[model samples]
Target chain A: MSEEKHQHVVPYRVYVIILIALLILTFSSVGITSIELGEYTVAAALIFAVIKSFLVLTYFMHLKYDKLYIRVMVGFVFALFLVVIIITFLDYLFRT
Target chain B: MEHAHHVEHPDMYDEESSKIGMWLFIFTELLLFGGLFIVYSIYRYLNPEAFHLAGEELNRTIGTINTVILLISSMTIAMSTTALRKGHKKVAIALVVVSFVIGFAFLVNKYFEWGVKFSHGIWPGSEQMLAEMSQGEILFFGLYFVMTGLHALHIIIGMIIMLFTIRGLAIGKVTIKRPSMLDNCGLYWHLVDLIWIFLFPLFYLIH
Candidate 1:
């Protein structure tokens, strides 16, 4: 492996940008709670939550700089997790 | 001087390997908590009324503050790793200390919040006092206690790990040439923060 190729630097500006993004997300989540969006209120909250999670995972967590295999492993693990969630959901949704 | 040369072996796997190992550990952690989430979701779906009503009793402000604290800690820990990688040892040490102090603050807040709830008889099977609560409401508290309790355990473990990292920095066992110790510690700390990110909404936000 080329040492120079693997060595990378993250600028300070990136941290400030992510901080602003998280603050915006937090405010929006609190603001949306009051709107009577029916059942979709939770759905909307989750959507923003997922976006915020992505920002933290990608930038703050540095998963963005990881190798391809590591990324694949993370994706596979999450896919398996979704399967578990889905199976449980079906179990509750179908009710014996 | 002899020991210094021994620790500076360039052929050793770099910081990236340690970070990958930490991530793989977190992968297992996800599944461990995923099992609990599976149970929570199934019960919540079956008892929507109970879940929503129980959720309303939680302090939204406390949950929100904890969320911001965890998020900021994650950012600071990330910057800590960045500083170590750039060979800025003093900045790196300062950032790690900040993360540790913030983490302690989070646990202190959690202690008070949980203490108040316990005083109000919000424990499992405290049916005489939880009489106003429904059966599913009891289950909600059960799950809440288990999930957040486990997360708190992880935070304490992360703090212990950070302590060792700090000691390593002080003794010069860790340096930029091999910064994986801090990187791995940061990875573990970030996972603790990420878990709370999900927990905050699940317990505090209900529709």
Candidate 2:
């Protein structure tokens, strides 16, 4: 409670650059998914989405600038989410 | 720095704890949507063909436009947060208003898109859906409406939150020294966009 944390004010230029990158990723996902990639299509699209979400989480959500405890909490939450999905898929996959 | 403003509002403003609390709330929201995502995956796996076919009926162009719209809104809100922290109240409010307008545009697009589907009797429990669509297709549309409907609802709520944050900024309740309110609201706005990142590919681009 006595500690003074130096608040990181992210630069507007950085936000602009991130926005441009997000736009590129958005269009790239759209263009690539439009092609016939067979089974890999879903995989490709999801990869783009995961990257996009990562950017949003890290920059826009201020997770990157936040303290370690906050980052750890977010990481834990997402990791838990992934584990749930994996386990659920296991149950579905191994069903007799 | 915080001590300078400590006297202004004696109410203990624990920034880190406040942010932590918001994150905890976000985890719950994530799980709520996460449950629906599980349902979607199971059904999609069970009925891939039907899900794929039904996914085709959705307008990819409109979906892409909405995706861009949301991404823009997310950027503006994020920028607004930075602006507020940097002591540019007017710029901050302007960015949020931009976000609000774009968000409304997104809803308008969704309304028309849903209207088109409704006109074709494509809603849940519609006679055409039940009689014509396969079970998988029905499930696909059902999930579509449920997922997208819930998402649209979030967008509306986020916009409303933005309005309040704007008012807070207008009255000087939220400022450079006390940016927690706007920061939390920005977090929520980004969460809405984060969900759509997954929803777009799953619902619209899966053909």
Using Cα atoms with residue i matched to residue i, what is each candidate's TM-score against the true structure? 0.91, 0.95
Candidate 1 local lDDT, B169-198, one digit each (tens): 878878877777887888888888778877
Model 2, span A1-96: residue lDDT tens? 545537888988878888888889989999998999988989999999999999999999998888788899899988998999999999999999
Clashing pairs in 1: none
Provide DockQ values for all models, in the order shown: 0.62, 0.84
Q: Residue B20 in model 2: shift from native, Å? A: 1.1
User: Local error of candidate 1 at B69, Å?
Assistant: 1.0
lDDT of 2 by residue, B13-94 (tens): 8787778888899999899999999999999999999998999999999999999999988989999988987789999999
lDDT of 1 by residue, A1-96 (tens): 537436566665686689778878876886787578878877877787788878877888777877788878888998999888887677766877
Off by over 4 Å in 1: A1-5, B1-13, B127-132
